[model samples]
Target: METVQSQSKNSSTDHHDHGGIFGEKTELYFAIISGFFFFLGLILSKLTPLPEWTSHSCYIAAYFFGGYYTLLEAIVKTRKGEFEIDFLMIAAAIGAAYIDSWAEGALLLFLFSLGHALEHHALNKATKSIEALGELSPKTALVRKGSTTEVVAVEDLKIDDIIIVKPNSQISADGVVIKGSSSVDQSSITGESIPIDKTAIAPNTKLPKFEEIDSSNVVYTGTLNGDNIIEVKVLKLSKDTTISRLVKMVSEVETKKSPTQLQTKKFEKWFVPAVIIMVVALSFAHLVIEETVRESLYRAISVLVASSPCALAISTPSAVLSAIARAAKKGVLIKGGRALEDLGSLRVIAFDKTGTLTEGKPRLTNIIPINGFDKNEFLEMVLDVESLSNHPLARAISKDINSEYGIENKHRSSDIQAIQGKGIRARYNGGNVFIGNVEMMKDAKITVGSEIHQQMDELLQYGNTVMLVGYNETLIGLISVMDVPRKLASQTLARLKKIGIKQMIMLTGDHQRVGDSIAKQIGLTDAKGNLLPEDKVKAIEELQKNNTKVAMVGDGVNDAPAMAISTVGIAMGAAGSDVALETADVALMSDKIQSLPFVIGLSRESRRIIKQNLWISMGVVALLVPATIFGFANIGVAVAIHEGSTLVVVLNALRLLRYDLKE
Candidate 1:
């Protein structure tokens, strides 16, 4: 787990993060230092015995303390052969100092510093909920040995280790409940407010029901252990756990950006130069007509200072920050501004079948056996083979077989081979034994009869993937695995439709039946199956070619490439993969699938606000610049309107904060 670092005790925004030394502490120190010098300048200037030079010295000190970073940044930009708003601000303020308007210069520095501090505060506040989730992550897990318990780093916990979870402690890992029951506070994970009552037989067993574990039986990392202690078997370790992945994903999201945000930078490349031209023209005209160079320059500086686009600069990010803040409040962590922009434009949302729409756990749904073999014999032999394998399908077959026979398979064989996209082959009892689907058996020249084919068709109708196992060229038994759709999957898809998304589809690496089953259940119009990561990307490209702005939502390591290819790549169960988070444009913190629509709606609303702010700012600037040149407006009026418009733009952007987004 990453620590959130804090340097000063008095600091309001000190949380340890993995962002190294340049996080909250550095920002706070700069703001505090600037604040100190500002008051120091004011105080030293009032000393009775001090000469003018000493007062000037205090102003210089204030500038160094308050404006040093800005000055250095501006000079660095100059070295890079690019001029920015920083250069313009510094030039105007230095000119104020040259004219001996020390108060004006100091005021300029003070206001700018205050703005910087506020921006930092706003960003800090925006990320607090996400950081809070990180802070609440468990550092240690309890290892239970017989009747004794030992605490160790969460990373040290292993699979099937029974861990004791005390009341109010963070659940240290994801695991099944072998024993105890309690109500778990899953609000952090699901954005659901109330505690969910977890029992012995809660739904979806492979992935532990973090909501249903008996307070006495199971615990999950980042979930609050309830009023009653729970005993749980850890199925995954700390680094591989869901919470750890989410924290890292959130960190990586700061860098995964949206296309619109990048385009906005390009927009600035042109917009900034045009604004400079307007500011220059206003100043030149004032000098020619008014015959007062000093007044003209001051008015010109005010125009530049007013039209600096600082408000416009913050315009896009403010909506982005607000969207992210709103999403975090709802347990959705969108990575950056661009993701928010793209979410608003989504026309099609392609979901992965395994985890995005399905529950991702397989169950034995059907079985078919050849004439010489009964269902039991076939199951027993396949379970014998599956018992030695660790794949999800293997574990599922084993679990189903063991439950039926009440005996664990102990048979072992050598030289086992798995055929990609098919099944397994092994040597057992001095004969060729196959323990996979019909494709695997057929490749080995095993005979398939009409009965097996009929049964396979029946299983396919029910959306089961049937595997035919054979020995000595004769079919032994058939194994079928079915993945259940998520309970809310269809409802979530319908909600997206309500939010104006026209196309909803499912993409999977599973067979066509498996994919189609889930797609139909979720009411999707299209379902593509047996796709690799590259195939998924190709599908996204095809959708985009059809003029559909597609968003691919997935949470697996395999889904990362497709996520990167989509117009907006959204990661479901975001805390599972760093690559998914790093590559995907948006992240859902927990398993609740409904927030996708909420975030999309919020983005559309945010874009509306951004457009409003941009128009209002531009409209006022267009009107006021001409008004100032013709003497219809004085310098003071222009400054007031200019500052007033900045405030108006900010307040208009703030309207996004009031949006209602709930499940």
Candidate 2:
């Protein structure tokens, strides 16, 4: 649904971002002049001795001010061979004047204009909130020159330029931390509840490409920095920052229409002409009964005013716009009304296993000691050897051990060596320690008993990589590790089910056991693995064969095909990636799983409000036309009721701006 809004002076982004709803002084002056003349003419012509034409001159002044934009819109629609509610409203107001109801005609245009202005004002408040997100990025950055730092415009900053971010300040651009350690609060851009710890990238660590990144070093524009200074190396130009991409998406929402809005447009195409035909037939039908021409035309004008369809034209877009703005505030970008409507009806949601479900890095899950070594003693041996190595597996093990035990590395290792096909080992505490696979332990003459072997077999079934630790040529412990599910993955799935999703599944390129292991941890109904992008699309098709609405959630690059096939394609971690922003129907800027349930609930709420607005608007017309025909209502009363319904629907749609799903 759409309406022709009369803009006062400027509709620029800066105007909407900072200015109040009243636009300028000219709008207020015109409104005051129109109301002053309308009331003066209505009372003077009735109570005092006044020439009728003189009173009409006052009414004409009211029409010129109040109906200026409405008349212009009506004329434009007419030249294009289109008829809208504005044209119908102006015609009915002029018909009232033909019967000498000049005061009532002025009242009609005044109320209609006021209703249109109010609706647009209310819609502006919702849109302004979405635009406010862009304002979070500061205009200037403290750029670091060779000797001293100089303040520069964010737009003037170039790639590879170093900028210094102060404590509790908004990040200036998309960049990486080169020096300093701090926790960057990404809630403004990514909606991650917790602030991410940011540290300078190590000199030895290989950095991933900007197109796909997950490092403690990466920082984005519009996110708040914690209480520490950080020197940032700009990775992107100012225009290509995540904040700019989001601003572009906000502008795009205006052009995209919901299915309901399109249907409303189709209804208006025929509804306007049909109302015109009915009014014409009614005029002649009264004349056939021998009623006077003036009286017949008068009644026809009343029906025309009653059947204006003002509320219907604005029913869907108002709600859709509000919902989109609300979702954007929560760090979820819904492309348009169609996606918002489709998301509400999602029956199945398929998740990509790597980044969507798991944290995409191996984490230690279990550590079991064998023989005489206690758990801490076993971990101390494992940490001492693994911390010296640089393998990915070794890093995973050492990180987990350091996080859990806070080991100070009491024993200084002397002979540390990384076996080519196996893991690493070192001499520590006057004893030889080994950390590797079962084959490495066995090759070193360490006993692998039935109990330890059975334990390793059980861990393998859950898709865990078991690493054996040995000391003095004896078995010490086994450490099981794998990529673990995200912290909120299981809770998010349960919340989705609570909101009426029927099934949850996982589609991934990982092994079947790994996929199932993640599914079990995250409460998914099914898990499918060893699937390429094409296979994911086929899986989406298979789910859709049951005629259910399916949604695909992924990191948004490899899963684009699957997302295209699903009913709703949601991209996770879209804050800085352009491919994710452009590909998915819904882009969750934050990589948090918690946002999934929130977006789903919001879409459902918006859909419900749109349906409710339709009912309220159509229901008013059902009661209105018959009352006007039976002489139970006059032109003044019908005009008042029509504008009243318009205001009612607008206020109802505005309810979505403050909508929140309480868990």
Give the clashing residue pairs of candidate 2, or none: 1-261
Candidate 2: 10-residue stretch with minimal lDDT:
5-14
Instruction: State, as a TM-score between 0 and 1, how close model 2 is to the true structure.
Output: 0.60
Alpha-carbon lDDT, every model: 0.64, 0.73
Residues 236-307 of candidate 2: C-alpha lDDT, one tens digit per residue? 988888767655544454334344445546766877788888789878865478677767787888887667
Question: Residue 290 in candidate 2 has what lDDT?
Answer: 69
The number of clashing residue pairs in each candidate reads 19, 1
- Highest lDDT: give the candidate number: 2
